[model samples]
Target: MDANSFLMGGGGAPTAKFPTPGTVVGGHITEPPQVEQQRDIQSGEKKFWNDGNPMMQLVVTVQTDQRDPAIDEDDGKRRIFVKGQMKNAVADAVRAASAKGLEVGGILRVRYTHDGEQKQRGYSAPKQYEAHYTPAAAAQLQNQPAATAPAAPPAQAYGQVPPGVNPVTGEISAQAPAGLDPQQYAAAQQNPNTAALLHQVPPQPGPQAGGEPPF
Candidate 1:
């Protein structure tokens, strides 16, 4: 029978066969773990399938320089699926590397085990799996410089007023000279010696009229 006949007769659907369990792969971490939301391709809907899942992912580039013909010929990179529990492993690796963490050139080893079958429709690979990371002793691992701390800015002391400025918010205000008492300072601010007088009233002509006109 044809492909459709076989499927209708309960033979099986076509699926991509993956490597068996207990396969080991070695590679350098080309991409660090980043938390990203999983979304549907067609409908653009978020997919949260796993319990206690963070939806983080990483990528590994297979070491082709090890002279392995299989890896050298085939595609050298693969995307790793990360879950909440697996996030711990990634954290440990990063902590071990210190400043470098899981940066681009860090080396790692992974062991493959059967994860489960994918139930999503129109997915070619039904029998999906995941990778388990381990510290690898490779020459490519290098230490990165530790991040430097930022310098602290100078702060003004409380209640210490600056020259001709308010102490609280650094605004302009009238100020008395140094070593002056509080009451003296207030008096000096209220009454200044060099203030200019605008206008003056002259004494009226004393009793100009004989009948005291409009005193």
Candidate 2:
């Protein structure tokens, strides 16, 4: 079949395969089918910051301001994109730059130029932990003990104990032990399952320099 559209001076391109789920057809008017396999991804991480040093991996989709899908000439292969870079990028440490107004879309940037040089642009999404966070944070969060402070001392008969305090506090307060636990956290991270689940980054086999995943 052939569908004609009055856009970009009008052209009747070849027909597209039946639309799939999560696939938008035109003007944010997503075809009803765009609801299948995409269910598992909660705010899919189209943009991801991998094992440190500012590199990023991302998924992307695109459309014109008129909301027309960029259908390819041949297989109707419209390239969806999630913009990324490792310069003095907003998310210097990771893709979480958007939360702090970092990374263009909080996770990724979307753009197209005259001749692909960015003559046009806009934000695509938030700095999703799912997308823009460093794999390190994932490895770290599992073992890092949820960003807590040192376990406060007992209710000093004299001084007032801090909040989140318990009756008798142990020496190893939630404040992670410097030498051992951090190392253990580092080690636990590279365990394939843990790495995949926590940070969305994979763990590499063989030996690493400091037990860390090069993150």
Candidate 3:
């Protein structure tokens, strides 16, 4: 290769010392009213892309009298935007709200507090704290005789219903149950032998009784 000469004559164009003709990626553009969801790390936001995705966002929802187009979100999802070094803000916010029982649709406002640590209170009181060997309140738990939960429509005892049984209507008590089922209570009543073995409400509806949803 000649140091001074312009053309050393290798027919093909020589490669530039510094990169020339910057790399250009080929992509097809879609028409309006269509979008693809993608994460945006630069702006610390999650968004749906439209067309070639050059713009940050587009007006997705129709304008309503209740809300201005400026604040209306493009999709059904909430506009969860976090800027300035927000890595786990969304996840932390969701967990905190869940711990406090604030659901997704419910409006929850978050305020930070800088309070110093304080005393911790226990759930059971009067006997504010339990000693290492102390027994629980219920005499039945103390006995621990193999028992079943209270049953529904429990057999009436003493013409007046039991603590868990509603006297007027045969409904099981909503409060803590003595036994697991209606049958168990009936068994206890019919054969006094098992009366002391009953332990829970049979018919007060809850997650256990409710059928599971589609997985």
Whole-model lDDT values for every prediction: 0.45, 0.31, 0.32
| lDDT for model 3 | 0.32
The 10-residue segment of model 3 with minimum total lDDT is: 126-135
Question: Who is ahead in TM-score, 2 or 3?
Answer: 3
Q: Pick the candidate with the highest TM-score.
A: 1
| TM-score quality measure for candidate 3 | 0.17
Query: If ranked by TM-score, best first, what sequence of candidates would result?
Result: 1, 3, 2
- Models sorted by lDDT, best on top: 1, 3, 2
Task: Report the C-alpha lDDT of model 1 over 55-162, residue by residue, as the tens digit.
Answer: 444333444223335443444554444444344555665566554445455565545455555567785433333443434434333444557988644333432343
lDDT of candidate 2 over 143-173, digit per residue (tens): 5556678876556444443222333652222
Off by over 4 Å in 2: 1-79, 82-106, 109-145, 148-151, 161-215
Per-residue CA lDDT of candidate 3, range 15-87, in tens?
1111122221111111121222444658946554355553332111111122235533422222221221121
* Residue ranges of candidate 1 with Cα displaced over 4 Å: 1-19, 31-34, 40-44, 49-54, 59-74, 96-100, 113-138, 141-215
- True lDDT of residue 71, candidate 3: 39
Error of 3 at 57 (Å): 99
